[model samples]
Target: MPQIAILQMCSGIDPDANLAVIEDAAKQCAEQGALALFTPEMSLLLDRDRARARAWIESDGPSEMIDRISEIAAKQHLEIAIGSMPVATAGGKWANRSHYFRPDLAPPITYDKIHMFDVALATGEAWRESAAYEPGRAVVTVEDTPVGRLGLSICYDMRFPALYEALGNRRCDCIAVPAAFTVPTGRAHWHTLLRARAIEASAFVIAPAQVGHHADGRETFGHSLVVDPWGEVLLDMGGDASGLAFCEIDLNRIAEVRAQVPALANRRPIPKS
Candidate 1:
């Protein structure tokens, strides 16, 4: 079984500052014997200005932040999952992408967020992610170190259980939900939703979240967590703060839980209304 670490980030507009915070957290996780470290969404820059965000986005290869983190991963010989970033893609559109970096590889495997957050919150806060990001069309499941098979997703995808069910059906033992959840939604749905996904799928749910206020005056709920296969939160950092939480995952527990309950196997197709 692999040990995992989740990094809770209160990243501002400064990319350099965010990198520094991540470096510190990664070092701590490595020292704590974490085989894989995960960061929150918008790992590099968290600016609200669409124009400024567009200016900072990169087309291909590695951005400054990615380069720095890649170097760190190689030096430490650690696997990393970067939460999300705004990357310039083809057709004059940007992608909200999550990166998975292996220590020995020059380039990381990237997964663009499939679900775009284009909705109005209960607090009258609205986000038109489609305006800035091109939606991804593929379901990504990677066989990585420490963890056997890992599935990747961004914030808004949390609301959709079908996606996770698909991942579990594909034999994903672990799922990463890197998010910048709003205060209203996070407070109400964050833990419950995460736990439900874990219980339903019988997999470990590792979520590193963005908490506190951003440069855009957007408030996010920060309670970065690592939940086990049994829906028990093993490590949780409550409130808004930049820190690292470590957990030793027992892979066998996943099989045990699934064998005991087997709800996933019992799922049936429902007729469309």
Candidate 2:
């Protein structure tokens, strides 16, 4: 069993200010005895302006946020999972990337977000993420620290259950979904979807979220949560400012839940019409 912490952030346009907040949250989580700490999407910057956001993105290795967080993780001897950042990738498009860093590694194990939010919301808020970012091709599951086999995903990916199913098939014990969910959608579907995913996959779900208003006037639903395999809410930081939420996850509980429910084994294919 390992203890994990989720950092709920209300990020503004300033990268420096956001980093300072994240640093403080990480330290607090570490002090609370959390072995691994996770952050929300666009953990460093939440700029809606395309040109300005593009300007802040870096090409090769780590960004200032990554380096700083890595240093902090090293100092605290904690494993850090950054939800997602905008990074320069091939084809002149940026990637919405999630990175996992251990105390020993200078670089991180990265996973680009596979699902892009390219729809017109009911509120008439249209987002073509593919216009600004490229999509990741593969599902990523990695092993490091107190939790054994952890799967990584970004915001919009939460709508796709098959992705999580794939991870579960690959034996992922825990899943992280760092999000900046719109207020309307989050209010309706956020908690239910997270709980369903946790129950279906028999894995602990770590969801660090962006709360409050962003510089772009986008209101994010901020109920950052950590749910267990049995659909229990371990920690819930209810739409607060910047905060840390912790949960002790027993890896063996995954097996226990799956054994009781046996839902994973019951999933069978039906013939297409």
Candidate 3:
């Protein structure tokens, strides 16, 4: 059983403050014997004001925040999965990117969030992620980690079953769905969708999340979850606060669930309409 840690955060507008939280969590994860530490989306900064946040968002070369995280990972000798951050692209659009940092000299593996969250809510809250972020085109997976082959996806991507289907097809052992979800949406769909994805993929779903009111006047639903292949909820850090939580990944459970359901093996490609 490999134990992993999740940092459920109420990240603010300050990048340095966020980095301090992560650095402390990394130290704690190392001390607690965790193989990896998973954090919520926008772990470094969660400001909704694009103009105010523009200064910290990285474009060319590695930003100080990224360098600090890399150093932290290396120093702690622990794998750290930074849920997502805003990174400027060459195309003049920013990317909501997830980065996986290893303890070794190996380079960090990154996955740009593919699904853009552009929606108008019943609560009158609206988001236009596509208006600023460049959507990713590729499906990314990293091999030989604490959880075997790990698939990467961000907040909105969890809503699209096809993305999980693709990850399922690749036989991932665990999938990361880091999110900074709004209260209304997270309440209605968070657990159900995460469990469904875990069941469908026959894999563990690790989701670290943002919780409580943010500095930018936004609130997030934060039941940071770890669901098993059998769709069992292993851990749920309630929405009330920000903190660190741990869960053990039973690697054998993957084979057991797949052996029972075998959904991935039985999947047939659908004909185009």
Candidate No. with top lDDT: 3
Off by over 4 Å in 3: 58-62
Query: Using Cα atoms with residue i matched to residue i, what is each candidate's TM-score against the true structure?
Result: 0.94, 0.94, 0.98
Better of 2 and 3 by lDDT: 3
Local accuracy of candidate 1 as per-residue lDDT tens digits, 90-154: 76888889999888867888889988889897779999989878888878887855887999888
In the range 218-255, model 2's lDDT, one tens digit per residue, is 88899998888999988888875767777788889888
Q: Give the candidate number with the greatest TM-score.
A: 3
lDDT of 3 at 252: 99
Model 1 alpha-carbon miss at residue 29, Å: 2.4
Give the Å error, residue 84, model 1: 0.8
Model 2, position 120: C-alpha lDDT score: 91
lDDT of each: 0.85, 0.86, 0.94
Error of 2 at 60 (Å): 7.5
Q: Could you give me the TM-score of model 2 versus the true structure?
A: 0.94
Q: Please, what are the lDDT tens digits per residue for candidate 3 over residues 35-124?
A: 999999999989899987876675333366677888999999899999998999999989999999998846689999999999999889
For residue 98, model 3's alpha carbon misses the true position, in angstroms, by 0.3
Native RMSD of candidate 2 (Å): 1.7
54 Cα displacement, candidate 2 (Å): 1.3
